[model samples]
Target chain A: MIGTEIPVLAVLCGDRRPPDMDAVEAAAEIRYTDEKGLPDALRGADALFVYDFLSTAVPGAWHAADRIRWVHIASAGVDPVMFPELRESDVVLTNSRGVFDDSIAEYVLGVVIAFAKDLPRSLELQRQRRWQHRESERVAGRRALVVGTGPIGRAIARLLRAAGLDVSGMGRRARGEDPDFGTVHASADLVRVAAGFDYVIAVAPLTDETKGMFDAAAFAAMKPSARFVNVGRGELVVTDELVTALRAGEIAGAALDVFDTEPLPVDHPLWTLDNVVISPHMSGDFVGWRNTLVEVFADNFARWRDGRPLRNVVDKQLGYVPSGH
Target chain B: MIGTEIPVLAVLCGDRRPPDMDAVEAAAEIRYTDEKGLPDALRGADALFVYDFLSTAVPGAWHAADRIRWVHIASAGVDPVMFPELRESDVVLTNSRGVFDDSIAEYVLGVVIAFAKDLPRSLELQRQRRWQHRESERVAGRRALVVGTGPIGRAIARLLRAAGLDVSGMGRRARGEDPDFGTVHASADLVRVAAGFDYVIAVAPLTDETKGMFDAAAFAAMKPSARFVNVGRGELVVTDELVTALRAGEIAGAALDVFDTEPLPVDHPLWTLDNVVISPHMSGDFVGWRNTLVEVFADNFARWRDGRPLRNVVDKQLGYVPSGH
Candidate 1:
């Protein structure tokens, strides 16, 4: 049964058909529209789902809202969507933090296997009608450092370990013990830890502290055979520094799924590098992803209706502060 | 303590410096040389370790005095090294079966992920400096039909299942209850079973029965989105038929590690297909693989000394008859 005091929701997204529509409908009186039309829809809304504001200019309508008490983002990272007005508002903010963990983790494993097994070279050989036999590295007994102890990082660690890799995780703060991870270290020790591993995976959320985290120094610290993989926010890595690392052989290779600039310009030098694998900020895009989003939204709706704290609530100070309990 | 009897050994290989020289010496009297030198070495040897040989040319070497009692093959497949004379002799033949399982399994998983994530398209987009966000198929819920329930096949099945895939294994005989695999089917039902799976992996040994196993009829029965992967012997698949199927889009794509012709002649058209991935039988080569082989040889040597039946004994009639016990 619909609650008597149904919370009104205004969805501001590029795609209106988010998989979590049923949950949104069950939790509140939801109205879906593009970001351009969001201001009109937010008039009496109690909550809002935002996605469109990341690429395009922020709409003035969101700033004028007084009735909207909560804002939930469909993405794992909310740095692009965060604005001065929204930050200053009393509205509660949340995000889809744990949803893309397994999908992105699987993508990371794919790239690692590709690089280690010389798959790209094999493809090139096949193109030339050449059968070349070459020895490739194995994943077993290799060291991996996962920089981010969130769901995505944990999932990557699990898969890597399953493949017989020795994986270590680094997070914002070192926990005494973690059931899901091994030897959790503080973020401050990431560069030192990076030097010891054959592969470094970045799955941390974007924040002021994480911005430019994988810069010149970080790459310089990695082993000459090490490969870097970023499935998190783009700004966390400095692209220019990464390009230099690939060209100079500071690191063996790199696979990037996110970029500081979307629709990377046609003339960018990164396009020409042989050792880099670039994707269109889409490591988490899997078939039926929309439906998965809908499921998360529905579950959150049930909690909202029951007057219980919603899951995946973002900390106002840090954004996506994973639950401690 | 050393054994009272110093057993004579014949090592027939292309390279004299076998990686397991120390282990070989510790086990028995070692006579190391290439295939051309095998005849002279065979006169005094009690056991033989053959890496490569000409089956038609080396018939007499297997029948020298019946003193050469045990034959150990360094490769997973004994086809190239196995002679008809040796098969008919009273010699015990054992192979390095489990040595390459993990390495080959890693390669299979790599190709599977590469196809599902549309990695080829991503690589092209990167080259064109385009940011195209497309939804990729996930391996999580996909069904895989592994044709060959050997160690390599089982290893591949385990890795695929760990990534959330539903894997079915097929073998020579259908077991009513096998706890290790899901839905074990007989090889005769391959064409019917091929229609429903997203991935078909062939790791069966080369035999008269398996020759031309994945032909035009098999490809025609497969789903349009299905992919074929062969890590087994090359003769098991018809190369021309595979080329035709790929060109006609009868199957989505294929990754081949072995070819009917080694060094896959420079002019073969199979190399030109963008959908196909080809490698020159290096999936089993990994760092420290030689050491693993040595360990296997050492364990087998101890068993042979104790008069225990060997682990990977190949059945002369059936060839690689799995221990029903």
Candidate 2:
């Protein structure tokens, strides 16, 4: 525990940071800054709250983070903060895990239904005022393979099953029986398992083992009629292979929210693909999410002040919580 | 029942009709025709199976339908066959009920999620090759008012509820406690209830009381952020009023699958409206729906042969069956 002489907490924020963090303010002395001002702000701070998880500010400012003992990221994925130095350091790591579970589940379900109902074609016709009746596919009783056993993946599995899709989950291994997903398969089965499901959703975290996990082989193994959705890290998939597969009609379609390069360039082929659906990574951000982030940080701040074990502590070496540990 | 001699059934077909309606063919001596040859095809028919419900040929050949005892429409909406002469005739009108229920429900849930997830905006951004992050709304626990209590409406309600929407159904009357919808409200309460919900969906059959039900006054009652979805007959809503409501932002957006005049016309203002989604009156045409319609007709045909009361017998005056009578 740090000296209780009003412990200093450095908060990293963007322009649209949460308006009020009263619980955090009441518990600690705070300093906030964007990337430009981060190094100076990190001076004398015992704790760090990464409110801007997407910012490249962390690495640049890490050398000056001498007093930091506990680093909390307001994001489910700890990839941005798991640097080599931090992983080997004494600083504890925590993340916002449960926050985005339900919101992202809604996103996956939306994309699934959108594809099943031929909504893209409908919207295209709507643009031309063309009243062309077309037959759509049914979603119920269809098979779905969600390749992540985390809370977000489980939430999606539960909701998809409730909405009548036959859902199966895959994780690092078949880690005992899960109430939501019967038995999660190892990542090795992903390529082989691709053909059986109509919808293959990717929500796995980013790591050496998972990076570019869905490549040419996996796409080739999928049924020609199947669709893919990626709400996880952009690096989890090989964009070139996916593009080749889509162009060659190896798979029916793809709904890609996260991309290998965010702000996917104007010249990117994905922008013009007829069968691809793209969204700038906003699936987990529901209305008032900023406020929720603040609440999560504040709660953790209260725990830190009381010298209690922090919530959502990450198993730094594994790259994520064994379960948002 | 008619004479034991194989009953002559005139099957109305369009250019793209369901292939091999073997069930109907095996049960009855079927004669087929498009609009041009309908009159000659109906010359000796004991029963008329209006498979091409969209064809205007029914009205044109109604005067020559002297021997027609029963006119079975392969559709849920009987409006196409409910001509002035047919309404006054002794022909038994039966529809393909129960087939479209779940399919249309899937469509509704799709659009609902699309709106909540701001998927339209996402697609628009993708088209512009812009990566802009935006927060979306949660579909779970959001209230929805479904303005129909028929099978199609009930199916939508059930699916929406499963997808986590707080759903309520409104029927022509509160007939009884429905297992799926519980105590449904009267259609008269639609306007009053509209203000309380985030989504207002219309799936009612076309009838005198329902025609122009959703007009200026009804639109005014809806929340500013509310979205309207119409999967029912086009005439059930006043298109002009809907357009006006959309322009003024009386409601957030609309997903109109049916229109009073379809192929909604190239010069229609709705085509240019950014907040509207339109599909050509096909919310429930699943991949094998045509085959299912044939199976429904074949099943009803077998019952008719045994001299049993036909299922989905529409109440001539009311325009629809009372719970598939």
Candidate 3:
């Protein structure tokens, strides 16, 4: 049953195990393995299904991808899969794009409202059993600048707009009008755009143009009362500049789901900064996400079975899907 | 001048001082004072405006209400003004009901999303500089039961619906159909209704019928995974029962903005419970709220001067605005 008119998939997952593949099993010959067994399982596979995106096994197992024609990652971010060899190879790369839109939007809303309403102080006071009443900020009529025009960023913009925040968005270039964000701004205008917004959120991808975009100049351009959020890749920001901004009181506060260094070393000063909120790069993961992950893969598998052009294909050199696709 | 033909108003405020009353100063004689000076200030006044709602001066100053024709409190809850003499007096009573609607809705959204997304855990992890990624619960498709059909409660329901919650409301009785809440439920069926909802929020006012409504039986009726929120008065719940329910894990968690005691004792057991979140009764407050309070009172004052009926007239016997105008 080497080829047998069906594609063979090497499914690599984490300790929690891969999702049930019963629905897609009939169309593909799937062999399940943890990160450790990935190299052996990938030997002679026609496709790679990386269910556990955090696994570091893929780059090491690259040489063993004998006949693999395609690789699909069960995450929106392709940072873990951006191996030099894999990027240079002829293999097709696809991602789970729409799966996390709503959940991440909700997460961003949570952080925005938390900062606006001063929930942290409330929780702190609760722990101490102090009944000191304080005024909270209103979410309505506030201004926001979301930096990213991708699905996830747009979703965040939509929810914030619905909640009554005056919302605008920024992309690589100022392009077409978005139903939710209206005319997106060019990333170059960030410094000028930064001054008026009460909230500046970075959800752009990690690329040459976007890396270090949120530098000292950008932070300095923002209002003193403004807040910041990063749900995008960590490299999109200049970490030291952000820390300096907080220390100097250049901005009010920030909630970062991603950082310059992924496990942000224990000794890092960002850990102790009262004005910064640190979340372990988990704004996208939601309950029962694994099931949805498997469902997306299965949908793509059915398309691949009949020789259909795949959805969510990443342009290898560009590192992500092109705009307006 | 002591008993002038022009209407004299008594404005009682707190440490933040009275809101800017330039608009009303030209039309009416405004005498401003804190709790200490209110008794004397209330002398020969045509109207009383309790701008500093927290000051216990209103009750003490009630005996000196010589020429008082109308009283307007700058808050939704009338607990501070619900004194024996004021209740028995024939003077008109009105409150700033609609002013706090949107702000309290946003606060409720903050608490709901904070609990679902585990932002507290994120903050805790940040303190330790640990980048441990964890899955969070989604807000979409979650079921909610919002108690109280007043503007504040309905506003919460509308926003929650936009955020993708299946929301139902309960009023004094279950007769009419609400566009936002669909068919409202009877408060008597709360125990039965509590079983299915993921979130049970209390925004009902303090009243004879609603006092201590959420006791042991109500908590026991809820699903083990459910979360409770109280934006209503503290006396609406049995504090000891809520503490015991949280300890027994009958419900997953709770967030209380109002408690049986204004400054809940530092040694209260609820403070030590990890499953409960406590906030001082400031959910309706926002930045510049003092201005809004003053504006509401000023609007009512203009109406009073024109010999028109006041808005937000409370049904004293029932303790809140009854259904419809």
Give the winner by lDDT: 2
Ranking, TM-score, top scorer first: 2, 3, 1
Tell me the spans in candidate 1 whose CA falls farther than 4 Å from its real position.
Answer: A1-9, A14-46, A59-62, A298-309, B1-10, B20-47, B53-67, B294-311
Tens-digit per-residue lDDT, A64-83, candidate 2: 98788899998998888878
| Residue A237 lDDT (model 3) | 89
Candidate 3 lDDT by residue in tens digits, A1-325? 2334767899887566666688778777788888878888889998999988766679988888898888999988777788899899888898988888888899888889998888888877776777888899999899999998888988999898878899999987886667878868899999988998999999887777888999999999999999999999889989999999999999999998888776888888889988788898788889888888988888887777767878889877767766565
Q: Which stretches of candidate 3 lie over 4 Å from their true place?
A: A1-6, A23-40, A323-325, B1-4, B14-16, B26-38
TM-scores of all models? 0.89, 0.97, 0.94
lDDT of 1 by residue, A129-225 (tens): 7666788898778888888887888889988887778888888987646766668888887777778999999988888889899999999999999
lDDT of 1 at B118: 87
Q: Clash number for every model?
A: 4, 0, 0
Candidate 2 TM-score over all chains jointly:
0.97
lDDT of 3 at A91: 87
What lDDT would candidate 3 get against the real structure? 0.85
lDDT of 2 at B15: 67
Query: Pick by DockQ: which candidate is best?
Result: 2
Which has the better lDDT: candidate 2, or candidate 3?
Answer: 2
Q: After superposition, how far is residue A4 of candidate 3 from its true place, in Å?
A: 1.9
TM-score, chain B, each candidate: 0.91, 0.95, 0.93
Screening candidate 1 with a backbone cut-off below 3 angstroms (N, C-alpha, C), the clashing residue pairs are: A19-A290, A19-A294, A20-A294, A23-A298
Clashing pairs in 2: none
